[model samples]
Target: MRKSRIARSGARRPAVATGAAAVAAALLAGGFTAVPAQAATGTDDPAKALHLGPKEKLVPQGTITDADGTVHTRYERTYDGLPVIGGDLVVQQTRDGRVQDVDKATEAPIKVPTTKAKVTPPAARRSAESLAPSAAGGGSPIVQDQAPRKVIWAAGGKPVLAYETVIGGTQPGGAPSELHVVTDATTGRKLADWQAVETGEGNSMYSGRVKVGSVKIGGQWVLRDQDRGNMQVFNMRGGLDEDSAPAFRNAKDVWGNGKPTIAQTAAVDAEYGAAVAWDFYKKVLHRNGIKGNGKAPKLYVHYDNNQANAFWLDSCFCMHYGDGLDNKTPVTSIDIAAHEMTHGVTSATAKLRYTNSESGGLNEATSDILGTAVEFYAKNPKNPGNYLIGEQVNLLGNGQPLRYMDRPSRDAEANRAEGWPPSADYWKPGIGKEDMHFSSGIGNHFFYLLAEGSGKKTINGVHYDSPTYDHKPVTGIGRDAAVKIWYKALTEHMTSTTDYHGARAATLKAARDLYGTKSKQYKAVQRAWDGVNVN
Candidate 1:
């Protein structure tokens, strides 16, 4: 019934209007005049000019208050009471409300023809469900997670009325599925749908006898940490359905004996990884679980037999780990846990789509970058932090790391059948078009060069030989500053559709926000992008 309706509907998508500068200038002297200092200093306060229409509203997504009495608040805009995709922005100012700067996902106008949808809800769900497959074919049961909601599609160079639906299923692989589908409400055409399937830690196995968090439930110890957003780990034991899965329990609160075969071992790793990540965000980055709300999604381990990979799904708002090549090799490690969980962080902040070419690579790289930092922050001697991702798990089965930051090309996709190069040592045009795992090398290499500089060196018993695209020497700004700058750019500036070039601009803006525009730290960010050939 709805299938015939979908086939009949076809309309051209509207183009995004580009007049942000004219709007900004017009608002500079409007009744909502900025403070004297803001006007005198000529700060670009997009928030002051946010009154594009009365129906438009700015809802706060996050706020950062600094020790120097500066405030930065990120907001998501709603058009005609409908969520406006790609309509998020951040406003920064002094304590006295003197505007400093603003960052937005898009500068396009938000007006549309109307809020009514020609495509009915049932029609949209049918269209989205048609894209999903059977359970055996890597899809969920024929059940809608929720009713499809109307939204404004603005990321694809235009703003159009649409329907956003969450489909229930696993991707082609047996990972939890949260395939977000955006359907044109007028034409019934599918605009975009993303399944973040492509890609933790902890363990007594990897981190080695690490401290874990547990809570008492009905006088019995259950593997749940109340501090880190009440993160609870469930043992799948080669099953699905987390609601029925049992949580690892202990009478004395001693979780694992440090054995991979033991189910509790993976639980310990998951708990430890969550703790370290929570601590890392709070202490180093000054961030909480999601938007500082202290709410982390559930974590499920041993998801499927020989699952071999881990994934974060928006449907369950949870992270799932696999039993790896063999049942004995659970893929839970500190960096791995941090890596998967950072997917959650990226979703909550930048909302970077895992399907887009460039955004997907950045999404993966963001996880790798932050995951590496989490490992280094743990100070766990058994699992020392390094630029190499998944070194403890050794997924390659050759005692080699999954992906190398200092030298990404070292582990390119050897299987030409996969249709991607080994890896890229430096950024090149269309690098985003490469496999997200390998394309992520561009970001990884840039970060490595920025933190350690371009040269051969040894740290923590691991050797690194980082190079640059221009073959010029790029000075190290230290990982401490690099991580800070990256986290800032990700949370405050980046958008869902941000590409490599956009990343260059976002990080530079972040550096200017943190250190002065003239500071050496700012220069390091510019040089780092240049080293990656992003310029």
Candidate 2:
């Protein structure tokens, strides 16, 4: 199902919330960005979940159509006939008709002295452009194009008549940005100001016998990717910080001896992984680089002594790899490298938290999904791609993969001693409550089900048996299609608070956008979620 790309602004709305009811209490606690409400009852006349007083009016502002064809209508509120500044709210309903009252403000109704603005609109516009934030938000100001809009500033503690100004500008990195400033109508004083543009930064190794970028520095060939973001691999022997761990520089162009004894061996792996991962994002996914910026991030290898792990640090905007037990094996395999780097991508895109039940699992699962995609995209004959995480590292020293997507529970007994609980093969209530690495099975299973479909299959010599929760058969739409849908959802649709259900909706929406709502791929997404019991 291919549909013409059509963009429609503005909206149509009917009062209602869909899904579950407990979300009402959770919303008040800020537990969810959007929740399944009570729209399960009726579609024609959805129940008004938002209990607005008679004096208040809900003015529709914008709308978003989800992949499942559910309309999320955004609205602004007015009290006593005056618009409430920052009183933006959204009524989100999923395909199943689960609706919820989603809004930023959960405080009591606001009361302003009057709707009259003492400060003239022209004066407000002038101040909006001239008033540089007390602290630089890091940008040269662009002139505000529109006039200051009059509204009641009830978003803050107390309601006050005010003028809201939208100031345009470019961020330090030249990304277009907007600064929203709210000023008190009575006085010209700035009440609040914030940058509306968001930017995130964060980047990886193991590959079997691979090609890497090198640079000539002081007559020495350094492990730096001059071609791709200058991604350098540093030797973090034991100390922390880049100061102690200088980058690997070889007197000759040749690097590594294919043995763990040679320090450059691990560096070779890390550097190659970084180069491949970088190319994977740039060529395969069409992402320029991590954070979608062309600049490459730093890489730290041989992280801690005998520390069998690897990770990405968004703060340092670098990827770190550790040596396995006895410091003989480095955890810088292709999948490991792509996996850690994908963490940074997740940070930059959805900004998913590293903690929490559902979101945390999603944050980790995202890395695994994209990492596998990068591995497959690389098409390395030596390291053929498989639906396995950390397959090359041998973390348990048993030749067993870290987490198995087809049947996540397979790694249970092997990794159990490492404090990993048995992973769920399918979604169940509280599945996300497990360790993220294990809980991620729900998403992992969904992806596998989407990419390869259910039951027995073999790819790259790796056999897998994936089962459906309801014992129903699922037909795959192709690995490429599944990867595309997941990527689109993660970058464009997913948010920080997205849970398994939300993830399903986001992917469905992505599939619909890419293949149309009625396409086999769209139906595959639904079937995949059903296989995982997400719906």
Candidate 3:
């Protein structure tokens, strides 16, 4: 029997690789073309380089200017006047407007038949309802109509014309489920179904008596932030519907008593978490907000009846948190909040698929990486920055962290003893059976090795003994440099379908861009991935 992998501590494990020459192939598949850092002579319009014609329209989304003066302009594509879901691409150019390279999600020619849907909206809704799992406790299921879009479903041989229908409703456990169901436009056959909600947990019990933002309206203080996009925290009061939850109110700006008994206390932690996350992104990453548009996502705390999970819903562009175990333990820690919110960042940028084994693992790991960076950025005394994830929640009864980045194998051993599947340390056969949370160990381990190096070391008073698959030791590049490389890789290099091998290439490219190709940081990134057996 395969060994069960378990995390050593924390309330819940954060749910969430490849080769060299083969790595180049994966990068090319993701639409990345690495060009040498040299100025192009011509004054070619970057937009014109897209070669968009009358049948195809390109809508400018955003522009990212790298440290090397390379400008990356992103665009959303439309073919035949219909929005293409995966038809987004980025045009890279020099400061002189000379085209450098282009990275796209799909290169398949969008040559589908008539955009008119043969299947009625009602028919698509019924087809979606038939596939949705029943809610727990026999609660009547509610489904919302999502705007249908013309998309190219390319999973099967050739890209085919499809109508994408989204069905959003409550799950059996009171968790929100947003199902993306794709149906053939002509045949009405269900092509694919993917859940949009990414579920995890956060326990407010860890962050004790943190300060929260509030505004005094009329006579009472409410959980509204005058700063940070005026993001407000709402109290579900054990309810499931977010639309009905009332905004948390207080007599004074000071909130929470460092105890779970008071719902307001959890609200304080949740708001503080949001504020910290917002500040981290803006101050460190230069991102204005989660969407990079100076907008804050609505935060809902105390959701459902002891839901014991937290999730980021792309449909609502909101973050929802659940109360764990008897509605007392609210999942609202600093790392958890940052982790869930980072999902939004991932969606906005790479839009990595949360279902594909390798891509899903990358998606989860991006959250962990950014979330950890947020913790260190905050540097709160109550929750000092550490390599351990979800340490404050104490989800395992024992005072252990959910997952140890310094030594992910520790969680694998715990998982094995607990009869859980083995964590994916180095990719092996049957790895798909491992939970995304477990497969994330490989990434967590890789980052740790990259930032802190391999072998025995103590960070923030915690001992870590990391190992390499080839029994080779690696030197550290410091977390600061490591984070910049990772952030650039995620935003500028990687795409939705990028897997482990692709990640290896992306980070290397990021490093080369930031520090010259022959820099120690670039070499360190290679060594770190090698330590994780990604080479």
Q: Name the candidate that leads on TM-score.
A: 1
lDDT of 3 by residue, 1-535 (tens): 0111111111111111111222223223332223322222233333234554456655555567777688775555556655555566666778776776777666666566565777776776666566544311133334453435556565443567776665555544456655567777777777766556766664555665566778889899998887888899888888766678899877776777778778888788888888998999888888888777777889998887766677887767788888875678888888888888988888877777765356677788888888899999988888888888887666656766678887676766556666665556675555534556777777888898889998898877778888888889989899989988998888887776676877898899889888979999999999999888888
User: Which is the better candidate, 1 or 2, if ranked by TM-score?
Assistant: 1
How many residue pairs clash in each candidate at the backbone level? 12, 20, 20
lDDT of 2 by residue, 399-479 (tens): 777778898889888867766577767777877566566778888889999999999988989999998999999999888
How big is the positional error of residue 315 in model 3, measured in Å on the Cα after superposition? Answer: 2.2
Superposed by TM-score, candidate 1 places the C-alpha of residue 393 at a distance from the truth, in angstroms, of 2.5
Sort by TM-score, best first: what order? 1, 3, 2
Off-target runs (Cα >4 Å) in candidate 1 are 1-48, 132-146, 196-205, 216-219, 413-420
**What is the C-alpha local distance difference test score of each model?**
0.71, 0.66, 0.70
Better of 2 and 3 by TM-score: 3
Would you list the rank order by lDDT, best first?
Answer: 1, 3, 2
lDDT against true structure, model 2 = 0.66
Clashes of 3: 20
Task: Candidate 2: give its CA RMSD in angstroms.
Answer: 15.3
